[model samples]
Target: MHATQTPRQDDPLDVETFARPEQQRRFVAAMHRIAAERAPGSSVRIYVSIAPGDANCERWLECITDDLPDGVELLHYRTAFEGAAYDWDALASRLDGLVVIGRPKRLGSRVHVLGPVARLELRSLVATKPVLLFTHNHGLVPVVDCLSQVMPPEEAPRLKLIAPKRWNRESITIRAALDALRPTGVSNAGLESFRAVQAHLLTPFSAASR
Candidate 1:
């Protein structure tokens, strides 16, 4: 299935909750503008790739501030609704780093299984870029193990994991999620605390250009 370019009806971006209407409008506009200017192999673009789900998925993309690496642009990537036909190749090749969010079910975790091709394509894309994965701790370890089967061994370290042990996933807001992900400086509590997660998550992104 092809991913739609617009927000899916089930979960629209709630960026307005965090910014003034004008500010939010401009921010959304700027994201699209940056995405529009992109052409294959043109400049570095950091795409927040996702599998569809709850508010945290939306929050993951919303929380990233405009302040980014020099000449780096940000955009969103999501697959089209199940069984909807569309293209994936062009965008897949352009991704520099993918910030994946959500607790994706593993192969044997559920009664039904998934197709191999889409999963393979996604793994291939991940193998080629820096991937910062945010997920429920239990679900992800298995998911990574499964990916290891398909992903190139040499590129494995480039895929980092971030699973907050003390976070309240049920109650956290977009601002809180972003705050929790932000990078904090060196110190005993500072760097290791939830506040520094965002900063640490971004540390390897610059390497994606290589």
Candidate 2:
């Protein structure tokens, strides 16, 4: 099935809880850097997936599309309802990378799982490419647990973990989590591309702060 770009749905009661200004800045900066690195005349195609019924979904969509960089296109997809099977592979084939926004819930002492639809999308998306998961209000451990559920047993443990020094307050922590997936060998090209984006996101901000 073809991936349809979901229209932005506005909910009056929905509050801006996840997509913070700083995080949005970092995300957009990273996308711009990714776009710049593309071969001349080529565009970067990024598939952004969000769970169905997430109040913050439209917020993220707007943050990504607003003033988006040239040569970078975002294809937005809201995961299908529970028990619905959409052809994720066909969609993944046309994308350069994947970004999944999830709200992880703690199930146990150290276990976490994304919502049903988000978890399903995460499982499908990660099978072909490394996924950058943007999570809210959760730490690295919960995020790692979410990834482990979708990754192979051997590869899951091999995955690395990187966190900014002040992970609790920095948006770079999300980027660091994505970087940690390098050892799993999801997609070398995708990872390398993101490495450049990560550098671009961090270096300039670090320099300016100094």
Candidate 3:
């Protein structure tokens, strides 16, 4: 399969504009940390999970691709289980980790329904490897609640939840998930860097805006 190209730095969805300078630095640093831990000359492969008809899919792809470091590659997988069940096992074998852009439909207060296609990809990825879920419509808690109903209790820990609105509170969680993406003998400096700036990483971007 062909690799997804790095987004242009001048793109409208640039992470620099999506997030503040310091926040973008921290996020980029975190990405670089992941890239650094990879085996020498090897690239870190992360599967980006999104629905086929999602209007914001391109935005999401561009923003994420812009922030990633040189040694990290994103494999964009548009979930369209139209004809038959997808071969998730085969896909999982090729990915190091998953980044799911969840745009679940809000059903009621504190309730949301993760689309069938996204749910299937999450369930499959979480079972096979680590997954960092970015909830767009609602915050992480409700989306995690939805997943808990469908995902077995044992498989739940493999998933890390994040919401743009709650980035400050969840920055540490995001850092930890990135660390877990590819474990190595690297120091905890990256994690500490996130802690130092977690409070200032305010201003949620439009990607997670309702």
Q: Which is the leading candidate under lDDT?
A: 3
Supply candidate 1's per-residue lDDT for 132: 38
Candidate 2 lDDT at 49 equals 67
Clash pairs, candidate 3, are none
The residue pairs found clashing in candidate 2 are: none
For model 3, how does the per-residue alpha-carbon lDDT over 113-140 read when each residue is reduced to its tens digit? 3455556677776543445554443222
**lDDT score for candidate 3 against the true structure:** 0.46
The lowest-lDDT stretch of 10 consecutive residues in candidate 2 is 157-166
Most accurate candidate by TM-score: 3
State the TM-score for model 3.
Answer: 0.47
Off by over 4 Å in 3: 1-38, 67-70, 78-86, 105-112, 136-147, 151-170, 180-210
**lDDT against the true structure, each candidate:** 0.37, 0.42, 0.46
In terms of TM-score, which candidate is stronger, 1 or 3? 3
Estimate candidate 2's RMSD in Å.
17.4
* Candidate 2 segments exceeding 4 Å error: 1-38, 64-71, 78-85, 106-112, 124-130, 137-147, 150-210
Q: In model 1, where is the ten-residue run with the lowest total lDDT?
A: 138-147
Question: Candidate 1: how many backbone clashes?
Answer: 6
lDDT, model 2: 0.42
Tens-digit lDDT track for model 1 on 1-210?
A: 111123345633311122233533443344444444445335454555554434455444435433233333455534322345435566666655444543345522211122343344446654334333444332221122122223234534223222322223232222222232232233445323533444434332335756
